[model samples]
Structure formats: structure tokens, C-alpha cells
Target: MFFRFACLLLSMLLFSGVSRAEDPVREAQAVIANQLSAFASDDAETAYSFASPNIRSIYRSETQFLDMVRKNYPPVYKLGNYAFGRSKLVGGGELVLQEVLISGEEGQDWTAVYEMRLMDDGSYKVNGVRMKRNTTSEGI
Candidate 1:
């Protein structure tokens, strides 16, 4: 029947559209991994390539960004180990929030939360990073 054929066509179109939706979390993870690898190898240019346009605009050049990272986020530059914890899509998939744990040579441990934006190119990149120091209270 024509009705049956039309219904099947519609179902297929809907499924295809849903499947085309981008997975922001996965994209963000890949970007983060690329950046981390660059940092580990001291490849500033490669690491800067992973930065979002907004970040690149703020820093102007890869060298400047590298200097800022080395001067400000020393621990991240010296990071020895890291683990990606949890990632969630928020605001109806417009934003991705992820948490990462990092350890450095000085026995320093840090937890960082990243807010990523879904770019028009179907990729995700970090827009902001909020770091927290992991510590315990010295109680009496």
C-alpha cells in the first residue's frame, strides 16, 4: 500500500536526522587528548592548534599562549599524569562539561572542570577551564 511505503520513508528520514546530530562530549574529549599530548611533548604549536577560535583570539599567537600557560598554569605544563573523569552535555547539547584529574611531579594534584562549546564545524573545543585544588582540612 502507498500509505505503508510513505510511513516507512518518514521513519527512515527521522532516524537519519537523529543519527546526524553531533556528539559534543566525544568531540571535546578528542580535542582535550590532542592538547594534552602536545603539552606532554612540549609542542606548543600543536597544543595551540587545539584551542578554540575565541582562545586564539584572546592570546593572539601560539607563542603568547604558550608563555601564558607556562607562567600561569605551571602545573598543567608539568603534568605527569591525568585522567578524564566525567562528561555531561548541558543546555540541550549546546555545552559540554567535563572533569579531569591531573598529577604533577611536585606531588601536586588538581581537578579541572572544562566548559566546551560545540562549534559550527561539528567539533567541540574548550571555552573555559575552572581549576580546583584538592586538599583536606587540618582539623583539631
Candidate 2:
């Protein structure tokens, strides 16, 4: 009876760890959704808040980052009807890979693959995003 009890306790511990790991993915999804909503509303300050510190540092200022986004990823600024698909844990829960699809103005569609990293701050942030322009390409 003691052995069975010990086994059950161990199982519970393992399950708890798995549940903790899953939190990162959920946090990442929320962050991404918030950013998308801000973009749709043209609230650059709100959208910039969702970016990782590393990203913010790279851009130096929120205004600069907003300008870059507006100039380079204009379609993203007008994003709508976004959806996340095919999320997978990468590197033992240290990272997550997610496929994002968004519709733009005038029936335009965009697809991107995002790599999100779990930061030490207990928040998940997008580390990289690769926009897929061609659907016919099999390999990159």
C-alpha cells in the first residue's frame, strides 16, 4: 500500500510540472492576441507593450518600433480575423512554435510562423517570426 501511494504521489508531481510548462504557451497566446488587437486599433503604444524587452531594446524606443512596423509590415497594422494553428512545444518547453494566419484589408491574407521563448520573467515572448509568402514552396 505504501508503494502504491508513493507512485501516485510521483505521478501527481510530474503532472504538476507539465501543467506549469503549459503556462508559457498560454501566456504567449494571450500576449500575441493582445498585440494583434492593438495593431488592429492602431494603438501603437499598447501593441509595443507586448514586445519582449530584447525586442524593445533592439528598436530603442516604442515610437521607433511603431514606425518600423508601420513602414515595413503595413499589412500587419491592419490585421484582422487572426488565428493561431499548429502549436507545438519546442526544446523541452523552453520554446513554442506557432503558425499564425491573419486577414488584411481587401481580402489580403498573411501567414507567419512564430517562435516564442519562455523568458525568465515568467512571461512568454515572441523571439522570432518568419512570414511565409509562398504557399507552393515545400522547403525553406
Candidate 3:
């Protein structure tokens, strides 16, 4: 009976750690999804809230950030549909590399790779994204 209890306790501990380890990836995905939803709704402030401190500093205001996205990342600003692709964790979970396959409202295909960082307060924020047009038949 003691051995069985010990084994059960050990399993519980191991499973709990596994869940904690997976939380960062799930949180990162949620942040990205929320930001995209905010963009879809034209909620500039909500979208900007997901950006890292570095990005916020550079853009200065939510409107400025939205304007930059509109002018430079048209596909992201006017997204039709998006699907998550590969993901990687780096620097002991301090950073996440997430690939997103995006279809623009105007039928253009693009690949957006996002870099998200863990903030000081234990929240994940999008540090940057690199958007590129899909040139090959394989698609993003």
C-alpha cells in the first residue's frame, strides 16, 4: 500500500510539471490569437496591449502601432484566415518562435513568423513578426 501511494504521488508530481511546462506554449498561442482578433475588430488598443515593451516604446501609441501594421503588414491587418504551424522554445522558455500561415482578405498567401518573449511579470508578449510572401507551391 505504501509503495502504491508513493508511485501515485510521484506520477502526480510528474504530470503537474508537464502541465506547467506546456502552459507557456498555450499562453503564447492565446496571446497571438487574441491580438489577431483585436486586429480583425480594429481594436488598436487591444492589439497593441499584446506587444512587448520594446515594441510599445518604438511605436509610442496604439494608433501609431496600428498605422504601422496597416501600412506595412497589410495581410496581417486584413487577415482572412490563419493557421498555426511549427513552434520552438528558446533561452529556457524566455522566447518562443511561432510560425503562422496566413491568408489575406484579398486571396494572398503569406507566412508570418512571430517571436514572443516572456515578460518580467511572467506574461508572454509578441516581440516581433516577420511576414513574407509565399513563393513556392508547398505553401507556408
Listed in order, each prediction's TM-score against the native is: 0.76, 0.74, 0.81
Instruction: Give one digit per residue, the lDDT tens place, for model 2 in 1-140.
Output: 99999999999999998787667667677878887788777787887877777788788777887787778776666676777766778676678777777676677777766777777866777676777652322322
Better of 1 and 2 by lDDT: 1
Residue 13 miss distance in model 2 (angstroms): 15
Of 2 and 3, which scores higher on lDDT? 3
Whose TM-score is higher: candidate 1's or candidate 3's?
3
lDDT of 3 at 132: 78
Tens-place lDDT digits, model 3, residues 2-115 = 999999999999998878766787889889999999999999999999999999999999999999999988888898888887788887789998888898766788888889
How many Å off is the CA of 10 in candidate 1?
Answer: 17
Which portions of model 3 miss their true places by more than 4 Å? 1-21, 135-140
Residue 88, model 1: lDDT of 79
Top model number, TM-score:
3
Question: Model 1 shows how many backbone clashes?
Answer: 0
Scored by lDDT, the top model is 3
Candidate lDDT scores, in order, read 0.77, 0.73, 0.88
